[model samples]
Target chain A: MADAAISVQGARKVYSTPGKPKRTAVSNVSIQVESGTIHGLLGPNGAGKTTTLKMLLGLVRPTGGTFEVLGMDSTRPSGRRRVGFLPEQPYFPVNLTARQAMRFYGSLGGVDAARIPERTTALLARVGLADAERTELSKFSRGMLQRLGIAQALLGDPEVVILDEPASGLDPVGQRDVRNLMLELRDRGVTVLLSSHQLSEVEAVCDQVTILNRGSVAAEGDINALLNVDGRTSVRAMNMAELPPQVVSVAEEIAVSGGMWVFSMPTEQTRAVVDAIDEAGGTIAAITPKRESLDDYFAALLAAHTEDVAS
Target chain B: MMKRIWPIATAVMMDSLRRKVVYVVLGFAALLVLAIPSLPDYGLGVESAVFREVALALSYVTGLVVVLSLAANRVPAELEKRTVYNVLAKGVSRWEYLVGTWLGILGVMAGAIVAFTAIEMVVGYFTYGELMWRLWEGALATWFEMGVVSAFAVAVSSVTGPVVVVTAALAALFIGHSRSTLLGGEGAMALRPFYPSLDAFNVVNPVAHGSGVPLVYMLSMVVVFVGFAGACLSVGVLLLSRRDL
Candidate 1:
C-alpha cells in the first residue's frame, strides 16, 4: 500500500556448504511497517531477527523474498540510498577520528563534500558526541562508539532508518537517550524499524511490533492490541479508606499503594463503580482498559509458540 | 558506483597509514637502500651497476612485503570484525568493495615505492655525484608487479583467511616467475602461451645497468597489469557475492 514505508514478504535465507546440511535462517517471514511509525522487531537470540534485517538490507543473500523501501526494491544499491542501518555492536576503522569517520560514512551515504562538515557537526551533537568529535575511535568507549554509529546512520537524512539493538552497550542514561532519540525521529516524521531485545524500550516508543520465533513471525500488531487484556477495565481511586460494599463486590484484583486504590474488573461494571465511588466521597483518579506488561506477555507468547512447535 | 568506491578506497588508504607494519617495511627497505654501496670487492666503474642491482632488488622485496601485508589481511579482518556490514549496508556493490580494496593497496604501494625511490636517488647523487634516473623505471616496474600480486592476494582472500591467502599468493608468485623452468621442455612449450607469465614485468635487467625499456614496452606492461588485476578482481567479486555475509 502507499502508506507502507518498509515491506518484506516471504523472506527466506538458507546457508549451504559443500559438505554440510543447508540451514534455513528465515522462512516466509513478512512485515509491513506503516510510514512515519516506530516499528519494533523483537525476538530472543537466534530468532532470525538479524538475518531478516540483513536480507532486507542486502547484507545477506536471500533464497526467496521481496523487500521494498519507499516503493522501491530494497535488495539493491539504489533502493538503499534513502535508507540507513545501524548494525549491532557496530565496528569502525579504529584509526579514524570521529569526525573523519563521519565524513567517510557521509560520503558513502551520498552527502556532498561542502555540506558534510556542517551535517557531521550537527549529527555528532544530536547523538551526544559533540565533545568526542576529534577522538580516535580506538580510544572510544563502547557507549561512545554506539553513539557514533547512530550519528553516521543519521547522515544524509535517510527516510527509513533501521537500528539493531541501538542501546546494546549503553548505560541506563544512554538507553534513555536512545529511546528519546527514537521518539524524536518519529516526531520528525521518519519511519524507524527498531530491532531490540530490550522490550521495555520497544514498549515505550514502538506503535507497532513484530515478534519473530523460529524464523517466522509469531506475533505482529499494534502494541495496544497485542498487550491489552480483553474484557477488563482497570480503575484507580484516591481518598478511599475502604471501598464501598457495592464496589468491593465487583472488584476482582485490588491493591493499595501510595494512598491510591487500584483494581481490575469486568468492563461492564463501569457506571456502577463510578457512582459508588462518587457516593463514598472518593475521587476517581483514573479509569482505563487494563494491559499486561510486555515482559510478561513476551515470555508467555514465546513459551506457547515453542510448545506448539514441540507438539 | 565509482562515487562509493572512491570513499571506501580512501578510507582504506587512511587506515593503512595507521598500521605499524607499513612504516616498518619502508624503514627496513630504506636502510638496505642506504647500504647498497658498501658491498665488498666491487670494481670502481661497475660498482654503481651493482648498487643499482641491489637497489632494484630491494625495491622489489619492499613492494612485495607491503602488498602482502595489506592485501592478505584487509578483507578477512573486516569480515571477522563485521566492519564490512556498515559499508555494504550503505548500498555499496560487492564488486565496488573488492575493487576499492585492491586500489587502496595499490595507492599505499605507490607511496612506499615513491619514498624508497626518492631515498635511492639521494644516495645515488651523494655516492656517485650523478643522477640515477634509471632507478625510477625499476620502481615503476616493481610497483606494477606488486599491483598484480596484490590483486591475486585480494582475490584469494575473499574466500579464505589470512594465513592461507598469504601462502597461496606466495605460491602464485613463485609459479608466475618460474614459468620457463616449469615448462622448459619441448613437450611443454605448447602450453606456455596459456600460462600467466610475470616475466614480462622483469624490467630490472635493462633498468639497472642500461637505459630503461622502450615506451612501447612500458605501455605493454600496463596492459598486462590491467588484464591480470582485472581478472583476479572479477573472480574475487564473484566469490564474495556468493557468500552469505
Candidate 2:
C-alpha cells in the first residue's frame, strides 16, 4: 500500500443537528486503492460508502481521521488538483450547452484556456456525446448527463478518478460502453476507485474490492482471494455419462447440464479426479479453483454481519 | 484565482440572461422611464429635474429586481441540484465559488443598470431636448448598492433555501438604508459610526437636484462597496467551508 493512489485511514464523520440526536455516518472506515488499478467499493445504502468518498474529495469535512491522495492531504483543494470525482446523479446548469459546461469545468480544473475547446471536443466524443456538444443540458436525458459528468471529470487529465455508481441510469449498451471506457482508462495507467451497486459490474472490472456494512468494512482483499473458496477446485467435464467412482468419492457439489458434469472437489484431489474422468473416456472442459459469484458472497457477508450485530 | 472566479461569474451571467425575470423587469422599467415626462405633476421650470428623479427611481427598482432574482436562488439551486460538485471537486476553493457567484451576479446587474440607464437617457433626449449624463452617475450608484446586496444574498443562499435568502436579503436591505431613521436620536448618533450603513451609494439628491456627485465621493463609494462585499463574502465562505455539501 506504499504506492496507494488514494488512502483513507480511520475516517469518521458525525452529524449533529440542533434538534436531532448526533448520528455517526462513518466510523473508522479505511480504504487503500493502489496505483493503476480499479478498486470497487461496495455497500448497502447508508453504509457510509458515499460519505467516505465525500470526505476524501473535500466535499464533506471529516470529523476525524486522515484522507490522502498521492500522499497529499486531500481535504484541501490543492491536494485534489490531480484527482477527479463524479458524484451520484450528477447535475449541471440547465441553460448551458454541453460544450459550455465542459468549458466551465475545464477552467475551474485549471485546464489551459486555449486547450479547453479541443479537450471538450475530444472528451465529449470519448463519452459518446460528441453530437450533443451544442445541446442544452436541460434537453439531455439522465444517461446523457451522466456521460457529461464523466467527461467533465476527465477535463483535467486527472491521474485518479473516483466514480460513484458510474453506470447508473445507463442503458445496457451504454453500460457496456462505460465498462469499456473504464478498461481503457485502466490500460492507460489511470487509477480508478469505483463505488457501485452493480455486483456483476464490480465482479467484471474490479481488481480488488472492499465491502461495507453498517458504517464499517465488512471485508477487503483481492477479488480472487475473497471469492475463491480455499482447498476446493471446480471441474467442468463434457462427454461424461457419470462421474467415476474415485471422482465421486472426492467431489462434493456436483451437477450435470448439457451432457457435461460440473463439480467441486478438494484441491488436493484434482489429479485423481482428472485421471478418473480420463479413464471414463470423458474430456475435461475446464478446471480451476471454485469461485462464488460476487452476489452470493456479498449477500452472505452482509447477512453474517447483521446477525452478529443482532446477537 | 481570476481564472477560476471568472468562469463561475460568467456562467452566472450567462444563466441570468436565460431567466425571463431580467427581461420582464427591464422592459416594464423602460416603459415607465419613457412615460416619465407625461406625468401630471411636471412643474413649470423643474420638468427636467423631476424627470431625472423619476428615471433614477426606475433604474434603482429595475436593478434591485434583477439582482434579487439572480442572487437569491443561484447558490441554493446549484446546491439543491448538486451542480456545485463538479466545480468544487475540481480544486476550486469554496471562497472562490462564493466570490465567483457574487461577481457573476454583479456582472448581470451591471448590464441591467447600463441598459436601463441608456433607455432613460434616450427618452430624456427625445422628450426634453438635452443629454442626461447624470443618469450614468445614478446607474453607477445603483449598481454598487445592488452589488453589495447581491453579495449578501449569495452569502445567505449558501446555507439556506431561496425563500429564506430573499427574506433575509430584503431585511438586510431595509436595515442597510434605515441607519439614520433607526438611529436618529442623540444617543444613537454615537453608534452610527459603527453601523453597517449602505447610505454611501445613495446619490439621488446630487444627481437629480444638484450637480453630479463629487469625484471624491464616488471614489469613497468604491471603498465602501469593497468593504461591504468583501465582508459579506468572507462570512459566506466561512459558513460554506464548515457545512457539508
Candidate 1, residue A136: the lDDT equals 92
Candidate 1: segments with Cα more than 4 A from true spot: none
- Measured against the true two-chain complex, the DockQ scores of the candidates, in the order shown, are 0.83, 0.87
TM-score per model over all chains: 0.98, 0.98
Candidate 2 deviant stretches above 4 angstroms: none
CA shift of A163, model 2, Å? 0.4
Model 1 lDDT per residue over A1-311, tens place? 43999999999988888899988879779999999999999999999999999988888889998999999998887888888899999999998999999898999888998999999999999889999899999999999999999989899988999999999999999999999999999999899999999999999999999999999999999999999999999999999899999999999889999889999888999999999999999999999998999999999999999999999
lDDT of 1 by residue, B113-222 (tens): 99999999999889988788989888888999999999999999998999999899889999999999999999999999999999988987798777778999999999
How far is each candidate from the true structure, as Cα RMSD in Å? 1.3, 1.1
**How close to the true structure is residue A138 of candidate 2, measured as C-alpha lDDT?**
94
Clashing pairs in 1: none
The residue pairs in collision within model 2 are none
